[model samples]
Target: MAHPSLTETTARVQEIIGSDAITRIFRDAMSRTLRDAFVHSDGEEVFVLTGDIPAMWLRDSAAQVRPYLPLAADDPGVADLLVSLVRRQVRAILLDPYANAFNARPDGAGHAGDETQMHPGVWERKYEVDSLCFPLQLAHQVWRITGRTDHLDAEFARAADLIITTWQVEQDHAERSPYRFQRHDGPPTDTLTDGGNGSPVGRTGMTWSGFRPSDDACVLNYNVPGNLFAIHVLGNLAELATVVLDDPALASRARDLAAELAAGVREWGIVTHPVHGRIYAYEVDGLGGAVLMDDANMPSLLSLPLTGGDAIDAEIYRNTRAFVLSPDNPTYTRGTHAVGLGSPHTPPDHVWPIALAVQGLTTDDDAEKRRILDLLARTHADTFRMHESFHVDDPATFTREWFSWADSMFCELVLDVCGAGVQSTLDEEQVPTP
Candidate 1:
């Protein structure tokens, strides 16, 4: 059954958007996750699959349902769905803090052949920092938007502690952590280096991430964008700890960790490019190696304003944004139809709709946003749904015909342009200064 609120919201959007194509895509994208991706498990848990993939990625699931937050405030059904998904996420974290995706059942499903610590309930064992950060982000968002505390039960508190501990262990990964991942007969990015321990790195206060949000191995290890996202999420966890969990110790720990990561990023993440001036690097080693490109994924350098808000330096972000959107950045692609950020995860000259949506959401220019919206409306391959990536010159050539996260991102950008976007709870005061 469709949520009544979603039906009513779609009707309102139809009244606001003038283009028939835009309205049709907006309605489909807005309800895609509920209609196609969500799977109700036992009890109140709801497992949300990343479209076309049978597994549930912690980061993708959180993003797939985020556009529905505004409707969650007034609709009981929407609120319950959000709450249930958070509960499910908390359980997944407790199962394995290092796993990025999970199986709905403990049937030893997904990547069981990969060389790593594989659990029956885990879909993939690639440990990305954003995987842990996203669950906390969703839990906090659900609480903030719906004023619900049932999702933040004792189980959630336990999961929070495990998440913090896992991050702390990963801070000195060479000596303290025992996590390793290896895959045979695959691309180099599918596996880590140095006997599955990943590349070596010095002691930067920022935690080490074996993989990026793109599910590609990190070259420099200490991912700056992932750390920045972790810093923002720690602030959210601190607020949740103090207000709901009644645990000042946990709150202080989260704040201290956030401060440490922020200090690390300030010292090592910024690079003085000749053209872009001072801007954030994508990845860095404490010993002075940095990768100066961004991917088309969440927690990317281009998404700083959307995720970090006023916590980031406004002037530096402006410079960084200018660099990432231009040809200066290695992954920025330009063609006849669309120009946006592309990912190493996909083929050359293929731009992601997710990046375009993020670009529209973070911009201040109405004309720029409208231009992006028009481009998106025209380049859906007549499927009326967003795809993972499409050819820069031809919309007919695309990847992942059923990508739920990209669809949700498109819906979010459209809603923002229609003056109905949800405000992030990570305000200036809530986020730590970097």
Candidate 2:
């Protein structure tokens, strides 16, 4: 059920937009993305799927609910829903800290054939680092905006400890970790190298991920964008430990790990581009090799500033922006309909709407922000809901028509451009780090 306050706020936002057509689109997107995708389970839990899929992703679930955090304070029902979702995520983490997605019920839900330990509740055991980071980011934002820590129960504390432990083990994956994954009869990008263990990382201080945010296996184990996201999430966990959990030992552990990863990124993640000067790499092996391209995913190199760990004007980030948005990056594409970033997981010449929104959110220039908004407004395929990725040549032919994460992101972008009244309370710092 939609909260009364949420409905009231939507009306105010429509007034601010001052366009009946755009306001109707925004309202439709909110209903489709935020309201329709939420499921109230039997155990005081909320399960959110990425849409057209029957499982919940830790990253996608968090992003789907994030636009409602600011409104949580105005509506008790909204706060309850957000808190319940946080609790559900904690339960999912306890089920398998390494698993990126989960089933609402244990019915052998996802990827039964993958060469990894399969649990009944696991949707897919592709171990992406951003999966762990996003839940913490959402939990932190809920507490920050609502001035409440009711979500920090004993289960949450246990989940936080498990997350930190898993990250530490992944930091030494070459010798200490036992996790490996393989998928048969799939594309090369769908499976890992070195017999299901990913490519060699040389044990850099940054943690290892079996997959990228795109659900494609990493060519190099230490994904730089994932590590940068870790740095931000670890800081969020540290604050939660000290202020909410009152666990100094856990806080110290998080701080120490964050420092080590930050140092590793500074030492090895930046490379000298012949044309763009110093730029951040997408993936790096400690043994002096790096992938230079960026994906259009949330944890991609181009999303660093929007993801909130790095400053927008930082020298390396500027250089990286120059590289990622230009012809240099393989995934950067241009066509008659649009020009933006894409990913290896999608068809050629397709651009992601989330990436376009991230570019607008991160840019300080009003004209550039407006331009990106215009692009988004034009490329919704007349559905008023964002897709996973749309064709650069034709907006009508897009991928993943029911993806709620993209729709939620588009809703956020609309609120920003329309200057919604409720959005006035939404501090930039309170935005989802994912």
Candidate 3:
């Protein structure tokens, strides 16, 4: 099979989607990352900027190019691009596994004033667990979709070890971890509590994360969604270690950690709500403190079906989904323009395009998916591209005019609706649940 050109792919998508306006938006979104956000270095590394930030986020960079994974199977060029990204991510993880974002060069750029163990190559050391998970997920997906193991080289093995050790240390964060962040002259969410140590957390087998995927400080350290994502990615890493690396020890370590995290989530992350029954909590402190509201971020409670894979309870997820999309979840917002999940990172009464896209991708209801897609098209504020977020009442009032991750997610959702969805490796394996 010949690799389809961008033009050919667009035409193929147009057949499924009859509307010309939507087709135009889809084409523009399909090319946005490559044209505006991607930077291929002379040293064969690919750095993807998170749109208007001029910095590469470990999570956003992987997601920005994910919609092109299907093309990578047939196109060597696309496959090479994905491989380069994995290489770059491996280097970034080796540089600082705790850093969420990095500079294209070791230029000492981005938030140097923040009180953390700052490195010249690191853009922001927010220390979100999802930051480490995204790279592994991308590498596994590339190999699964393209049958290429070139990205799973020696450096990746070392990085995988570091990631595992880091998570293990974080499982006992107060005693074993050395991560701290304190930003002066910023919002409260920009810095951690207890002199940058974050709020104290009781020992749960789940790993600790200082920040949410939204880059905001966590009220409670044990982020349920982030740990769920970590469990899924650990399964990916275990498969890679078993099949590609031929290291049974590493595979066993990954599986054991995954089981521990799964046990922690099962014991501490689910709560019996009066209205929603047994639903997953967004964040838990293992000390009877749990936040039930869902954010608009990728690993949010509303996104458990997409990120949590088979480990997620079907009936609980259905109940949780109902609670999150309704007025029950504090962040669930409805206005004149659209109704969906929002984030504390954004202003109040705003809806995130990424959340809308996730809603469309995770649902089996065709009408609901189409409704979310149409809502996204109507709320782009005439940019023909997705933004970070827009006001629920007024679509024009938005933030971050250029966000590549949001655009890529929109493209993925559109492809999903068109029945040409990108394949993901996260759902291929199930984490052992207690």
Kindly list the per-residue Cα lDDT of model 2 for residues 125-214, writing each as its tens digit. 999999998888888878877766889888998998899899999999988887889999789998888888888778778889999998
Residues 264-370, model 3: lDDT tens digits: 99999999989989998999998999999999987888877667775688898988998898898999998999888899999999999999999998899999988
Candidate 3 C-alpha error for residue 46, in Å = 0.5
The list of candidate 2 runs beyond 4 A from truth reads 308-313, 420-434
Can you give the TM-score per candidate against the true fold? 0.96, 0.95, 0.96
lDDT of each: 0.88, 0.83, 0.88
Off by over 4 Å in 1: 42-44, 424-434
Window of ten residues with lowest summed lDDT in model 2: 425-434
Clashes of 2: 0
Give the higher-lDDT candidate: 2 or 3: 3
Question: Rank order by lDDT, top first?
Answer: 1, 3, 2
Maximum-lDDT candidate: 1
